[model samples]
Target: MLAVLEKVSFLLKMKVAQGFQTQIAGFYIYLGLMPSWSTRGL
Candidate 1:
């Protein structure tokens, strides 16, 4: 699963490098989908 996230992040980075404006959008979406918030002790 972590590998998958890394792959997705890499792809997103590639798109951003190509001048896509969705970089931060994709990052926030990724953050929202990540499970760390539920598992971590705040």
Candidate 2:
């Protein structure tokens, strides 16, 4: 029972990490596009 609980917790941690990574990637993509958007607006 304890092992199963541990495994579940580990999987949860991994999912959280993956989510954080995706958010960071999205932020970087937004940052990369900002300059082009600004230039186009002008």
Over the stretch 1-42, how does candidate 1's per-residue lDDT look in tens digits? 999999999999887776655777787787778799664653
Residue 14 lDDT in candidate 2: 100
lDDT of 1 at 12: 92
RMSD, one per candidate, in order:
13.7, 3.9
Off by over 4 Å in 1: 20-42
TM-score of each: 0.44, 0.81
What TM-score, to 2 decimals, does candidate 2 have? Answer: 0.81
Name the candidate that leads on TM-score: 2
Best by lDDT: 2
| Candidate 1, residue 20: how far the Cα is off, in Å | 6.4
